[model samples]
Target: MMRKQTPWLALALLTLAPAALAQKTKVDAPPKKLYCWNENGQRVCSDALPPEAVNYAREEISAKSGLRTGEVNRTLTAEERAQAAAEAAQRALDKAAEDTRRRTDQAMLMSYRTEDDLRRVFNERTAIVDNNVQTARYNVASLREGLISLLQTAGDRELSERPVSAEMTQNIRLRHAELVRQRQLQASFESQRGELDIEIEDILQRYRTMKGSLPADSAPAATTP
Candidate 1:
């Protein structure tokens, strides 16, 4: 009975050998077509890239499933490439500028507590310039008085038929020069004050705008291209 069972087992093994070989063949088969293209209204497929695909649209198909993966993108022209580069550069510049502005706004908001804070600082800075202007004006007034006194003395000597001494002549020239110098200094101070006023106004306006829009607890943001 054991010998009879051994022969039956051998027969069963031989019968299963062909099926195993078939399964192995299927598994080891070459890859199927991965791409297809339309040629004169007919679909053509190949595992290798088609030579005529230079101008033809390529449709990528899965090798295992025979389904479309996606359509391949075409090559860009020189003009298209240049335009895209220009647009990308412009976008980068715009992003950089925006990031700088955001950081500036954040810094401004953090530095000052309120709109009045900006105003207070502005007044404080402008006050220094105002002080300079006042000092210059005072100097101008003093010089003008001295100039008038010297001119009157010169007139007295001329009326008395006395030759105006060289020393007196030199004194009058020096006084006039001092008066001109003080007037120029006054004008410069006035100009500087005006510029300071404009700067203060600009800074105040920027502060007001940033404070209105930015949150009190806003954090610095990272920028990306």
Candidate 2:
């Protein structure tokens, strides 16, 4: 009877030991952390984030998550992209124009130290053009005389009751063509002279403005005709 009672007691202890160990494990386990997802402006929370959270901003702060707070991220819209490109293009244009202005101002200041110096340069440049104009005028005058001489020769032949020789006809035509070329040259020279005049006036006015000779509020200096 005593031996049978010992076997029963050992079996009862083995079953009680398993129950105690299970209870200890349950108490020692860590609590499950909560995760949340933001859908549009709404907050949806659970033990894990929903599949839609992949497209939305996530809120991990447990306290802040209850307030439904999260940051939204997205690509720019079409209109936004176009406006950004336009602004960048405008910036590039402005930078290029500014660079050109700076370079021009530097060159202008370096070329002339005084108003008299500017005038001297202007005169020198115009004098060269003036000489060209003079040469062109002389050439035109000479060609006109040659044309007149040819016309006179043709008149003489007709007055004497002789046929205008092919050679004389050709000579008159050649002289006329030469006269036309000279006149064209003269016209081009005059046009160039006018351009030089305008360019010189523009430079002078700019130089005066840079030197502070003209009042800042005053209108541009009137160029001499």
Candidate 3:
């Protein structure tokens, strides 16, 4: 009653196993590329894409991009918006300081007799004027950024459309005050520079006059130490 196994039968079973598996398998088509050939033998671009591929390099790249774009569409939190505005204002302030320094240097160079003159004898009104201009630019950027954001949020909330706030009102007052101060400072510096230029011109004229009046036979006098 014991059954015997045959090697030829086992080999035949193995040969038929692959065919049975193939019958159970699903249909698979060749991968499609994203590009299409134009009538002129060139590829035309489109937003749509083709079917899946083995490499999927392009699809992986697109997946990352989609994630980034989704992030972009997501709303900025209140804290984030405020922080961004503050950082922008800080950067503007730093640049204003740099601008003021450069303007002060240029103004002093134009009117000053020596490097020491900037600190010693020369006027400092131009530096005040430059400070005003830089301050104005800074305020403009800061205020505009804040206003735009506020207006955008207000529109989103469907609140009153007018762009106004206590902070903005205070900024406006400061801006006017700075403008007036800048004008007065500029006037003072300009008048001082004018006076200095006249003095230099008179000195040069007198020197020429004295040289023309000198006698040809006179010997030059040497200075004693």
Candidate 4:
């Protein structure tokens, strides 16, 4: 399990280390049971002698851990260099993704403004569309009514020459023109709508690409060996 706080763990270890060091047991060799006196016939035994050096497990802890050490030390290896290169590449990828996102946002904002203006134009043109449709409908209704009256009067009489009245011929020509003009305006609106749709799709595609390049937010990989 992970510690809630490593600072406290370090402090506790430091506090115990001094006391453990003070508790070191001294080991020494006692003199011989019978020793000869210096240049005399008398014999005497000497007391114990002190140890050569102090002994404690905690004494060399700092040296082993590379703290307060001498010239001997470990150098950075090839594997460490590779790991540093990997980290630098990762940072570059992140920066590129961030820049892409910024550019896409600017493009989307411009597209949105353009769409708003186009939408207004579409609304205005669609109004003219409604008017054209109604006018076409009125003309068609009147033309059908006149044809029915003529058919009732002269059944099965083909009039390909079609020169009955000047006003009637002009009415037929004008109604045909109105219908053709309506189709043209409808086509115009559809063309503008298609271009607007493409711009919207392009903006969305860039957004998805930028989002896909982001790194996952899971656990980080261990870098220390």
Name the top lDDT candidate.
1
TM-score per candidate, chains pooled: 0.50, 0.49, 0.28, 0.29
- Alpha-carbon lDDT, every model: 0.80, 0.75, 0.52, 0.51
- N/CA/C clash count, model 4: 0
Instruction: Write model 1 residue lDDT over 1-225, tens digit each, in one string.
Output: 354345877898899999999999999986575777777899878778856665567788888887887897656778989999999999999999989977977777767676765577667768888998999899889888988988888899899988888998898899889889988988998999989888778877887777677665773342322
- What lDDT tens digits, residue by residue, belong to model 3 across residues 1-225? 988866998899999999877765633433332322232454443344444222122221133243222111223568978999999999999999889966854443345443343334323544654565566556556655665665566565556656666776666566556656655655665565566667545644544444455575542343222
Scored by lDDT, model 1 comes in at 0.80
Clashes of each: 0, 0, 0, 0
Between candidates 2 and 3, name the one with more favorable lDDT.
2
**CA deviation > 4 Å runs, candidate 3:** 1-160, 217-225
Off by over 4 Å in 4: 1-104, 107-163, 214-225
Ranking by TM-score: 1, 2, 4, 3
Tens digits of per-residue lDDT for model 2 on 1-225? 465445877898998999999999988975444556556677776766566565555555345245543444534668988999999999999999989977986576666666775687667778888998999899889888988988888899899998989998998888789889888988998999999888778867777777685355643443343
The weakest ten consecutive residues by lDDT in model 2 span 216-225
Write candidate 4's Cα lDDT for 22-52 as tens digits: 6653223322231112223433222221131
Measured with C-alpha atoms, the lDDT of residue 64 in candidate 1 is 80
Per-model root-mean-square deviation over C-alphas: 16.3, 15.9, 25.2, 33.3
